[model samples]
Target: MTKVLLTGASGLLGGNILKHALANKTLDILPTRLGGDFSVPEAFRGDKEILPLDIRSQTWLWNIISQWKPEVIIHTAALSEPGACEWQRETAEAINTRAVKFIADLCEHFGIRLIFISTDLVFDGTKGDYLETDPPNPLNFYAETKCRAEEIVASSLHDYVILRTSLLLGASPQSLRSLDERLKADGEAGKTMTFFTDEYRNPIAASVLADITLKLASGNNRSVTGLFHAAGKDKVSRFELGEKLCQKYGISRQFYKGARQDEVTLSVPRPKDTSLISDALLTVMNFPMPSLDEMITALP
Candidate 1:
């Protein structure tokens, strides 16, 4: 059985991948974490060893690198919250940049393939559907670090795949639904005038996105080894997504007062438009990006 080591295994994206891995019982899924006590969740119902890991600690990580020698290493752990990263610069750099490069260097030393999960935030929203060749114009510190991390992984390792994904939706410990819930809660509590219609993203459902990540990791494809966009086909604004959710679940979108991004007091400046349109991924998949309506059906 092929053994795979996945960091951030308890996270939204990592959880989805863990689900895919568990279903293939023939494969050995070695998930890592310092805390949290649960199987990867959903379709993945496997035994665990509650591995104590802190990727930032070079000594501990290198030990695992030399011992584990996993064929595939999916690195997803990071301080992803943009505002949080803005305030907590040191922690963000340690987790997002330093730790990633450490693993990339290890991969470079020992022949291994590493799949890095990156974000669409790397672009400044000056444009959408930014290609792999596009120059990253990060608007915030979080995006800046992520963009740098991509470079670190690419230049550091020979066998690696860096996937730049857009807004993700699905259930997890800290799911992409966090933004929606925050808005919904704020609105319900009589807090209004804080939603943005100007900010745009091409969000893909977790279940669907998981398959794409796996496809990129399954085998060696140097052509697809570099950065690639992984997102949904349709691009929609935050307002539209909110409205669709309301319509789907029979709720009201009235609470959210639509405003432009500039009006908001976000610690990190957000990109105005970043709706990825990747024909690259579609060509490889048997069934490409799933429609929003189809996604709703798949939601738990």
Candidate 2:
């Protein structure tokens, strides 16, 4: 069995990846260095080992590397939420960039395959149709760190895959509560939502993204050790995504207005377009890409 060390086990993407990895018992998954807390999902509870780690500290990292000695490392740990990352700049830089570099070095030393999860926000919402090869124009420190990590991962190990994903959905127990609070506050305050019509992204269901992530991890690319766009097949505007949510849950759409990018108060600039479509992801499963509406409406 190939031992895989999964970082950021508490995050939406990391949690979902843990779910998918569980079904395949042939793969040994060790959930480690979860940032804040350890909320083990049912899928990973009985079958896997949970290792509490602090990726930022070299001492913490060395301990795990010495013990786990994993054959492959999937880096999902990050201060991903933009506002949180922005507010906690030091923590963000440490985990997203510095810790990731540590993992990359370990991967190189241990001769293991590395899979690093990145984001679409690396582009400052200026260009829409971004490819793996496109130059990154990060708007915030969070994005800047992720981009830096991507560069380090690309160059550090000869065998690694750098995947950039979009916003994650699908009822993350942690994330859902936050979303509900934000939406409820907005609804109650009668705050008019000005979602962008011009800025676009292809937000993939978290579950789907997880499955694709495993497929890529299972087949660690040697020749394809570079950046990849891990997203849905079609692109939709933020306005469309919000509208879909309101319609799906039967919320009043009165607060929603089709606004352009310039109208939004983005603390950090967002990409005007960051829709990622890949034949690589499409090839692994028989599932059809779910539109934002279907994903929202079918919420369990």
Candidate 3:
């Protein structure tokens, strides 16, 4: 059985990945923690071995990697929230930039296949449908850190795949609510939320990302090194996504407000359209990426 180490296993994407990994008996999944408010999903309580991991601590990371010697490490733990990242720039750099470098260096020395999960926000959003070959021009602190991490993995490690994904939409564990779920909860609570109509993203299901991650990890695609844009098939605005979700789950769309990127001012500069086109992944994997409606339909 292949041994795999998964970081940020308590996050929405990481939790979903952990769920998918647990189902595969051939792989031994070790979930690790970095920091943040995260709880182990009830279903994964007895199934996974939770380890305390501080990616920033080089000595600790080295010792753990040397002892466990995992064949693959899916790096998902990072300061993900754009707003939070903007507010705490130094902290974001420590976790997202420095920690990633530490992990990549270790992975390089150990010859471990590392898959660094990145965001579509890495692009400046001057244009949409960004390809793998497209140059990254991050707009804010979060994207800057992520972009720096991607560079470290690319230039430092030989056996690495940097997956730049789009906005994710799916059901998370009961302990942690997903973005879509949060929106729904806010609406139900009679809280009006303004979604961006000008800003767009190729949102993907968490399940789809989990499946793709596993496939890449359990493979002989040594030639598949470098960056790959993994996202959904449709390009939808935030407002449209919210409207669709409301219509699907019988939530009220009246509470949903639409605004353009220029109309609103945020602490951090947001990309106008970071929509991705995963043609390389699509051609290689030949797997179908579900549409927004399909993702909503499969939601529990």
Candidate 4:
């Protein structure tokens, strides 16, 4: 049985990963949450050994690492909100970069396999089909932090896979409002929601991403150490995605407008296209990557 330590168990992707990992009893999962509430699927509640962890604290992390020596550490915790990260640059840097550096140091010292989750926003998005070999040019503070974190992981350990993913679909256990849900709510409220037609991404369901992550972690392949793009096969703009969501959920399409990227002003610069090509991951795993339609269908 492989002992796995998963961080950010209360979050969207982390919760989904925990739910998936629980199906395989062979995986002894010790999920670390910020507080008492372990908000994963109820079916897998009994399967998890919850541990309270403050990922920002290096001392706390060291203590946990020393006490519970896990074989693999799936890092999912981060200050993911772009606006929040921009507002709280120091906090974001601490959580995203400094914390990752701490984890890398501990993992390297203990010979533990590390699976670092990264974002496609690391790219400047000038080119849509971003390859794993492509150079990262982060435009926002959040992306900058993740890019730095990726470097920390790469330089710190030989046994690590820095998986860069894109916009995630599917309902999270945290019940945090997703982009689709927000769009629906705005439409219901008789408000105009302008989606970007120029900005593009290849979004994947959280469950699908979690499944792929578990597969990689299960392989325990030391050779699979480097950056890999794990995202949807088809590239679509936010406008297209919004249209699909409206069609699928019976939302009022009239309430939204297809605006270009330059029309909107944001706290930080957003990439025009960060859609990733998963050729590197697909070559190794024989499974088909989900299309935009397939991902939308999987959504609740």
- Clashing residue pairs found in predicted model 2: 125-270, 125-271, 125-272, 128-273
Tens-digit lDDT track for model 2 on 94-114? 889998888888888888889
Off by over 4 Å in 3: 36-38, 174-177, 220-223
Residue 147, model 2, lDDT: 89
For model 3, residues 60-114, the per-residue Cα lDDT tens digits are: 8998899999999998898899999999989999999999999999898999999
* Per-model TM values vs. the true structure: 0.90, 0.87, 0.95, 0.94
**Which candidate number maximizes TM-score?**
3
Model 4 residue 43 lDDT score: 47
Worst 10 residues of 1 by lDDT: 175-184
Ranking by lDDT: 4, 3, 1, 2
For 1-300, candidate 1 gives per-residue lDDT tens digits of 666788887777777777777777555777786455554444443555536689999888889878988877888788899999999999999999999988888888877789899999999888776777788899898998998899999888877888888877776654333444444455556654345788788878776777777666564342356667888887888878766655554455555567787776776688988877677756655445778767755665
**What is the C-alpha lDDT profile of model 4 across 22-81, one tens digit per residue?**
887678788887665445566434555667888888899999988988989999988899
Which of the two candidates, 1 or 2, achieves a greater TM-score against the reference?
1
Model 4 regions lying over 4 Å from their true place: 35-49, 220-223
Off by over 4 Å in 2: 35-38, 41-49, 175-193, 219-224, 280-294
- In what order do the candidates fall by TM-score, top score first? 3, 4, 1, 2
Give candidate 3's error at residue 202 in angstroms: 0.5
> Each candidate's lDDT (Cα)?
0.75, 0.74, 0.85, 0.85
